[model samples]
Target: MNEFLIKSGIAKGEGNWYSRLTSSLYERIVWQKLNNPLGYIALALPSLLIAYIVSKMGFAIGVVILALIIGLPLTFAAMFYLKFGISLIIVLSFFLLGVKRFVGDVQLGLLMDFLIAVMIFGLIVRQVQERDWSFANNPISKIILVWVIYNLLQGGNPSAESFLAWVYTVRSFAGIMAMYFLLVYAIRSEKDIYFLIKVWIGLTLLGTIWGYVQEHIGFLPFEMAWIMATPERYALLFQAGTFRKFSFFSDPLVYGILLAFTSLLCFVLATGPFSKPKKIFLLAAGMFMMVGMLYSGTRAAFILPVAGLLFYGILTLKKQVIIAMFFAALVLGVVANVPSSNPNIVRLQSAFNPTEDASYKVRMRNQAFIRPFIYTHPLGGGLGSVGEWGKKFSPWSPLANFPPDSGFVRIAVEGGWLGLLIYSALLYTVFHVGIKNYLLLKNPKLKVVSLGMLLVLFSLTLANYPQEAIGQYPISLLFFVAIAILNLSVKFDRKPELLHA
Candidate 1:
């Protein structure tokens, strides 16, 4: 019976009759035209006519028509090609919120949610067709599942101030996390990994260049308008007699921390068995990123690379690594001590002297005040009881106004001490998996990539303590991708020949 169904094209798979019908129509209508020069003229005439008509209608109508003409097919293509979807997620993370400067207060995050959902649906379709889910059955994936489950269960917490807040927060916490499985499933080859890394580094270089422009030249008119839209935002961004450059990210903290961690990845990758020109490029990019971090004026960003390198050095336990660490430390020490009037340098120095900073002291006080509540409630005030959701949905609640400055603190406040413990275990498992893979991998290239990934993970983990490093837009997405890549590195080690291929 099964064989008969398969042969008859009645099976519930990609080779079914419905799929064949769609494929035939798509080929005849789209592919043939796209592939043939004569077909191009046939298609372009109608498209040009529609474009002319849309232009006559009005600007907004024309824009909508243009978007539909482009976006619909691209969306369908992304759904079909999970790699393209994943790549879109990565690219958008860098510039999605930045779009607010041009478009005004649109709910762009919903678009991200839609993209992730599409990717997950694509994964499901692939799994159904292939009958294989083993790629996503790794330790990192399991822990992410556990974390998502915990966050989902938060909606039922009786102490939760608003179910709507849970609805909002869980979209990010549980919904966005599904990307981890999608990424793990999609990244099946070494080439795919390298392509994604190139995308990441290329975007980072652009961000750094924009940041340099902002520092030396100035904010473009639209960016200035966006900055001045809110007085609080203006005050926060404009510090120490100059505006802190955020590049393409939402804020300086996100921009600076991203650069700090990715620069560590760059430097680590340069140490791989690659060609001299590639190594030089990696080193140059890493230096550019570090310089960009300085321009961000985010004190939390300053310590991350140092800590990441120290972790890497200890893990390697090589004489040369020790020597390198010594020189890096000496440079940092001189920079910290040889005080300059430059605000960027002063901010850098303050990162090392956290106790002396007014903001640091305030954060400490807030944590102390919030600690007793965490101790009292096993599940704390519940998810979304603090931070942006709290302010939006439960403005009257005391916790609503509370600033859980650190990611850990936010977790503790929302999920309580028990939740914090679970979150911590997840972090520990990621590190354990990454370190185990790095130590066990035999291929030199795989080892280098795995080590670079692990160091970036370590840096983000540490940064989460001082800033909400892993919870923001691109950073959060990148954090999961890094873990997926860490697990993937080990998988690639089994097929070392593929590295060259």
Candidate 2:
């Protein structure tokens, strides 16, 4: 068995950690079990129990068991490898909620929280071995720490209506922030950043393709079933005589914002120091993503890329940027004027003409009404005092029925005006550092990459004004990762040796 492990390259050398661990595991599990009757019975018991359960419960239970068996290796891989874990979390974020379409009601979203917790543990173990923590010593890390502390303090908010609501909401509030520090610590080289960007862009392209299919072909049967399961959902989605395209995300809002911001990122990266083939692909992907964003029928999404472009143009102040912005404005003007009864086009046009939108007016009214309550409550209503948490945990409260449509509004209501002030400071610092980093970077490629991330962040920031943008799964995860990259790009620029650090 030891010889086989060495031959198979599982054990690099005789006295290494891998060799001893694998050799010991093999001997104890296979060799010792074979020589002892009780050991053989112990191994057989698992198979016998599995067979009995299958026989009694049927194929579904057997299938579940098989899935768990398969998932065990994947889970362990994530636990041991930080990069693999981050990539897995991002991939799962894209489809975790969508899985409910086929699987029925289940706490699948919690899987993200679980993965984050495991990765945090893995990070701690790795830190113990390495004994170096300087990677996270940056302004980005400091602000994120401040944000996490504030969220955790929400549990003690005297005005909090329900402690249970805090429990449910704080997981995302303070918990997912762990990924930022993990990423800052784990990312040692430019290649790591490239790998992460590739994973993000590749999955985003797949989502764009899926959204296109749902727009032209139609949703899958299960997706349709999921949409029609609730009347309010069906009504919300089935807009303008067609259902909005959510792709693999939880809702059209999340899907559209993702496509919009990622498309902006792609377009910005196209101008980076890359081969012509890569540039062409980025341009093509950006177009497809724009199409997907339009199909989502989300007015908020319609403005994100436009906002991103404006931000990019301001930061660069180049002739190419001026030309790009002109063309963008021209294209949007044409779309707004081209007399089209199509709902998607109409929705896109309406984004530019917000004053005419009834929903926009309603959102404004809600924000106005909530302004007084937010001002009175310094700590806000607590993390989960609004949205579904409020509806479930404190249904009788006025805030329960109130709809905080925007991310900023939700934060203001839940965290209070003071919390909102701190959150806003965090946002301001992110952009302040991001812009400063982008300006200081002398490397062209690093500059473009930093600019791309900043633009994406800018789009998300704009999106939060109309939708709960960064509070969702993939967006929240990706947002922190982008910040980490942006903060590190300047370091890479300053010392090229850090590119391979």
Candidate 3:
């Protein structure tokens, strides 16, 4: 079994520590040999001194200071060696960001930006040190790079109310693009791809459990306080529903859309060439996430999951999956219409019947209001002109007060019709390429992973028509990660899953 594990690269060679040197600089310089009193004393002097100093300071402050002094460098080192450290930080920010926002003014996304900046610095240093300078300088990266440059140009626009606003918008949007390229350039093999997919879905599952608990049971004190604080937002809930399971995302809509995507992906993966136990686990997780998604009361997101499932079937060239998916949907519909149907069915039915929906009416009005400005100012009001970004940054701007209502409209308000076209073109380009590659890629596993990502992207895009899905945390991070994975998958024809060293 040890031999098998070693062959599989699961077991690694190690130093049986304490006696046999793990070969640290201190091990040779101070230790000289295990339990040598003089060497031990020399090694212990700095730590012992720090402990004394800590005893003088309060324990908490001293520990914090010590962590900052020591832990930061260690974290940065891990970011380089593990290569997924930045990705994990980005993921964690997604998981905790909404909760952080509930607390106060310290922007959680800014922390993500800070970590990425450090990651970029460390990545540059590592690449230079190793003299290994290969990058995924493909069309997608180039397009994203150009888009970043375009956002940078927004910083100099005369219309921008606050320089900080422009800076934040450029950094937020362009940073997501940078993240795409970073993941693209960093991903080495199928192993990395699998690790990323698992982590992404693992977080989704965790979020589903949280959201389910929030609805079926109750929220934590902080969450309840935040929910109570915003009485006005209750009207904003889908159909003015009493409770919506937002989980760790920015809102119920975002959470529901993400759950829809992840739920579909889990179900698809369950049917793959996996062990029976793994398949069963995936199936159960998918169902649990689905229940959480239903609790979100996000009618707009409901339709997209079906679209994703259909895309999955088409992409995989599995007619049976399509037939089964339709059958499942039919059964769900029948069950939904039963005499004792779930209240969720009534809420979701409103998705297809939105004529009287208050939110839908408001959205229509918003679209009408934004159209004239979009047509007149074809270039745009600027990046932060409308939506939450607008209110926080350009509160004085008239456009800032009015909601943009849709991601598509928000793009139009910020970047103009031309900008929306360009953005849409970029997305379609990736989608087309992913579809083409799904058919062309020789490796079935690569095909499955990349295709699943494309479907998720597709679902998110559809969901974005009603809400800004991509720019939000976790979604943005995960979306770009998928794009990067798809970009890297293009290389499979030339090289297999193995790393180049």
The lDDT per prediction is: 0.86, 0.87, 0.74
lDDT of 3 by residue, 1-501 (tens): 546645644344344563234334344453355357656787699678878878887787776777588758856764575465655665665666675856665566775676677777767777777876457456677667766776677676666566776766778776677677667667777777777878888889888888978887887877766666676765555344467778877788778888888887787778767689988998998888888888898887778777887777776667788788889689767754555345677777777667878879989988887788889776677878776677897789887887776788888887778778778878877887778877788776676667777877888888888877776778878778778888777575458638331
C-alpha TM-score for every candidate: 0.90, 0.90, 0.84
RMSD (CA, Å), candidate 2 to true, equals 4.8
- Cα error, residue 380 of model 3, in Å, equals 0.8
Write down the TM-score for model 3: 0.84
Tens digits of lDDT, candidate 2, 413-446: 9989888898899999999999999899998888
The ten-residue window of minimal lDDT in model 2 covers: 5-14
Off by over 4 Å in 2: 1-51, 498-501
The total of clashing pairs for model 1 equals: 0
Error of 1 at 200 (Å): 0.9
**Colliding residue pairs in candidate 3:** none
